[model samples]
Target: MLILPILLAFQTAEGSGYKTNDFALLGSDGKKYTVKTLTKGKPVFLVNLYDMEGSQGIADLNRLSQMTMGKVRVVGLTTLSTRGRGLARVKELGVRFLVLGSDDPYSILDIVPRLVIKEAGSVSYLSNTLLLPDRRLTHVWEGYNRWTLKRMSQDALKYGHVRLKIDFSRFPEKLQRGYGEFYGLGPG
Candidate 1:
């Protein structure tokens, strides 16, 4: 058996403070809004999605949207061909929360640098970090796995309960798909 090393980064909970590293993303209304401003000291979940052929991103969005509501703000960032394509894709995927423009990759990249995976044949996007009230990264889910997403969302709810006013159970069933999806995630 080969011994594998485990890397861990210990991050503490942040207090009430906003920082400028905060980015502005184009909202569904075509308005530029600061994520920090929207979060407003509450934990924020930023997800970057790509719509090519696979449905992983859509599935993730669907489940996350169902599970999160008032518990934590979840934003969907997509990279479609055009404005119309991005907006249309958002609707087709059944995304309930606000979705930023395709050019907003920087916002998600700043939060999680390793979100994009460029392989020999294809590309895979990963990571969705939960920002604490004080603007620190509290939890990070490297990939769009259901179990990990559930735990991350659950952890966010728990953290929200201890910091801000939130309702975890109010999160929808589709959102909990990260916990367990009978249908396997789509192709990469």
Candidate 2:
């Protein structure tokens, strides 16, 4: 029923040639990091920070991190410099997850171009989360939704050998993905 439409919403006309190159990002500590090195085999939840802002963003991030605690590692990726206000916004949200930014911002865009919308002055992402389970990368996610989290939790339990108990009240049951496809660029 509703899921059909939601799934349709996430369908992308553009083919996604997701690269496997090690994605490097700068942390607030002035250190360079990569997802493989950081996760250490744990399931990693990669979120684009600016894709979400304000109170709702704060709550969703905090809860998602808490929900998958230990079972998954939550990390944030940004195009901002590690030393800037973008880092400050992470603190403002009170999200304790590790956040890293790319020194060459285009690198971040390269990884998830479908998520970005670039105009004359501003850029934005339609999706907020990328849930990377320990299994196939095909199932790697590009949006925030209870179904995806639930699926991720299942993946974590089965693949990462960890259990999870998450409340899905705050997130929508359908999908918070690809709303941008109709508007502009979308997850590729």
Candidate 3:
């Protein structure tokens, strides 16, 4: 009976109280940004570019940016395997938010285990669709689906304290999988 509940626990969206850590990472603009710096009094949305493909999730972030009207900070963190692709896609789409390329993937090392543990319901705060308005985790999601975007929109509304005209028509219908946000490889 206990085993059944344990498995079912991870099948739904779980709550989070995970606190974020600070680390400086090199951005595509050739600048260094830390969680503290990006979040500074604004909600920071961390979107992971798992494959660095031209996923609709990028555009989804853009739309959320527009909806928030600059009230939130959305940063895209692509996997090391697909490093540099985020900046390109952001530039290609003329994205409003900052999409980063890693100069040092080690910056994420401290946080990955926490996220993984959280998603497994062993701890808290998983998913690349993360909301870190402060050091405390606001929310984390497992997939970049329409429902998640809607949740983000709700977040925007709460943070922005403004009425939003949301239109999900252009958003992608397919659900995108989450990546581990892992980076940097060492050779023995």
Top candidate when judged by TM-score against the true structure: 2
* Lowest lDDT 10-residue stretch of candidate 1: 175-184
lDDT scores of the candidates, listed in order: 0.50, 0.57, 0.55
Candidate that would win on lDDT:
2
Arranged by TM-score with the best first, the candidates are 2, 3, 1
Name the better of 1 and 3 by TM-score: 3
Give the worst 10-residue stretch by lDDT in candidate 2: 11-20
lDDT of 2 at 31: 77
Over 41-135, each residue of candidate 2 has an lDDT whose tens digit, in order, gives 77676665543344344466667877777767777666676667767766776756677776575576665444443332234442443334322
The runs of at least 3 residues in candidate 3 whose Cα sits more than 4 Å from the true structure, single-residue gaps closed, are: 1-16, 51-56, 81-96, 112-127, 156-165, 178-188
Give lDDT tens digits, candidate 3, residues 42-101.
666676543355445555677766765556666766444223555666577666666654
Candidate 1 local distance difference test against the native:
0.50
Question: What's the CA error at residue 54 for candidate 1, in Å?
Answer: 3.4
Question: Global CA lDDT of candidate 3, please?
Answer: 0.55
Cα RMSD, model 2: 5.2
Alpha-carbon TM-score of each model against the true structure = 0.59, 0.69, 0.64
Positional deviation of residue 44's Cα in model 3 after best superposition, in angstroms: 1.7
lDDT of predicted model 2: 0.57
